[model samples]
Target chain A: MTGDGKFNIASEKHGESTVLRPEGDVDMSRSSTLRSALREALGDKPSRLVVDLAKVEYMDSSGLATLVEAARNARTQKVPLVLCGLTTKVRAVFEIARLHQFFEIADTASAAIEG
Target chain B: MADTKPHVYLELRSDPVYLSGARQLIASVAQRLGFDEMACSQIALAVDEALCNIIRHGYDRATDRPIWLSVWPGRKDGQDPGMLVVIEDEARQIDPTIIRGRELDDVRPGGLGVHIIKEVMDEVEYEAREPAGMRLTLYKRLVQKDDSQDADQAGASPAGSADQGRVSNDG
Candidate 1:
């Protein structure tokens, strides 16, 4: 589905893992697109899934909810989901929500895949 | 000296797409008021969350409903310079006592919007409008740590860009 002008998500293979790179604002409006992409990515059933948020400038609670749901699904499937390259602003949101301890995070996509 | 920047009142449709526009408007006003990049983003994010609450839970995702947003730079009660954001919606009256944000440790969705708003803004007030609906007012103090950093602030558009938005001195 087209994310309109809000954001873009592209899927690529990184070693044994599948990486979903989403760039732009991830608010309530663009979150459904991200959720759909995650669902499709998990359909591949990769051993590991990593979301690259390096280029994401903003993310609200809806965006956070999408990641949480994806992580839960991945856990049940025994696939690791790693989030990487969060901007300071986005990182702050996770911290404020006290969700930093719940999800696996890495400094880069490659680092996430390695771990 | 107290800040007396002109107030800008924006009336928008409850459409989710216009949310992006609202964030841009608040960010620009906050930046020009001397808020730093992070501060501006925080203010914008808080306002966005408030709008989301109105559009989703308040208006039941009705895109045609009306939402009112007002912004002005001023000093808070404690003498700190800040911006005031007032959002009004003619939707169902939410119980203010039961409107507490959920504990964050649960690791769930759907409840973080109000939590984020309270965390980012300095003061938050919710009031039932005169006859119906709810009014949410938020305040954020401007504290610039690095004034030299570039803020991705949107261009200042005169309060009225479309029927969705208009500027007025009196809120």
Candidate 2:
């Protein structure tokens, strides 16, 4: 969140799920903020936690690590952590790392929440 | 290999705070050299991961230590053309042969740095500095775009081409 001026985060409750929309590059400098946001989203114990990365232009391993860490915690808490709206660049990163199968990816935030 | 020494060199302290500046520098250089957005992002991510490892493993998160980064444009020598990045740190020499990214199937956080660097960069090499420290070299081949895009890009006004530039600063 501190790295790029375009970075922004907004959270909202959608039915049985909580959605956290992050806009901007998710790198080492901003990954901690993402982690904290994830923690905050999970604190309420929603049935599903959705992260909308529609505006995320870039994501590094740190961002991926943060997601994985949060996903592990979510699993323990019985909350499904869903990620959606991955840009081509972000998707390529997941593919190269061979981590696309580890996550529950959706095409949209609404779909993530619905599923 | 066309005398492709670094045209830009940056010296940074081994601190986490400098990571943002380092990423920005890589992104700028990649963009200036005509890398697409995706390519630029990948290059930035690779360099960022490299720096993170140097700060964490090499210097033990010691913010006062020195880490050097150099960037150079690779020439078209019947190979993929792109940029080369070198990162040098004064941390204990690491065995490049033993460095491995844990299997992706392991499914965990915190160990993805090495994997990300190796995955994104076309070529990765490591060398132990004499006596102490290490140097890591990463190469990313630029993807050639359609000629129309290049022509459109060429229409822009030009700043005098700098053959090489060195920037020494405390980060």
Candidate 3:
């Protein structure tokens, strides 16, 4: 994908769905970049917003917190938010915080867009 | 015989830019200690959260504050070799007893750092450092290949077990 120093985020649109892909480690240092991308995606008011984390290898609590805040914002905007392709490491973070229960997840962005 | 000696020591500023490098270093060490991929990632995440706390709360987001981290090969009882991570910071100190993860039902950002650290690590202790600042010690036991199946099963279930580990904030 694209590189912004240590982290990268690439965004695209498929029909009414907007997909944001963040690569590399999403930690305290790079979470704000992801946050900004998510906010911009939501601001577009797409029918659905999908975060494809297939490229993200590591995520800490700050990254989780950023997504949690985004999920809340998406809810307020009535935009469906979906997370797909969580690596084992990132999934464990979600599982540890029990955050897996809060967001809609799919195996892939296509599945999220379809369902 | 278990080695309880500190194997690595790191001194860093309270800057988020160094978080990724630190995580990689800790994960590599855990992997070398025989922790599986998942276990290593969890350990690294715990350390990252600890440092984030030190940077955010302890240093009040100041980028130049000093933070010290050390890793020690450890053993729990006479079984299982593991790692003990100690993080020290010189910043505002507070009552460790009052440090608690917020209710998950609140469904909010922030507060999950403490919860994740406690859940991932086998033991977590918070104590006020002398003069100024706090010291957080995290211990996680390495699960053997045979025990990994059981751990995986337990992990698949809901995560509200009081006996999952010990988290003491007795500063």
Q: By summed lDDT, which 10 consecutive residues of candidate 3 chain B come out lowest?
A: B162-171
Give the whole-model CA lDDT for all candidates, comma-separated.
0.80, 0.79, 0.82
Residue lDDT tens for model 1, B75-128? 423365568888888999977878878987688767998887887777889999
Q: lDDT rank, highest first?
A: 3, 1, 2
DockQ of each: 0.37, 0.39, 0.63
Give the per-residue lDDT of model 3 (tens digit) for B8-83. Answer: 9999999999988899999888877766566677788889999998899888899999999998766533354678
Residue B150, model 3: lDDT of: 72
TM-score preference between candidates 2 and 3, better one: 3
Candidate 3 deviant stretches above 4 angstroms: A1-3, B1-5, B75-80, B145-171
lDDT of 2 by residue, A6-109 (tens): 56788899887899999877877678889998998899999999999999877878899999999999999999999999988788778767778999999998
> CA lDDT of A21 in candidate 2?
91
Cα-based TM-score, every candidate: 0.86, 0.81, 0.89
Summarize candidate 2's per-residue lDDT along B1-171 as a digit string, tens digits: 556557899999987778878989998888887776656777788898899888878887789999999888864243455788989988999789988778988888878888878766778898998767999988876545444355345562111111111111210
> Where does model 1 exceed 4 Å of error?
B1-6, B75-80, B143-171
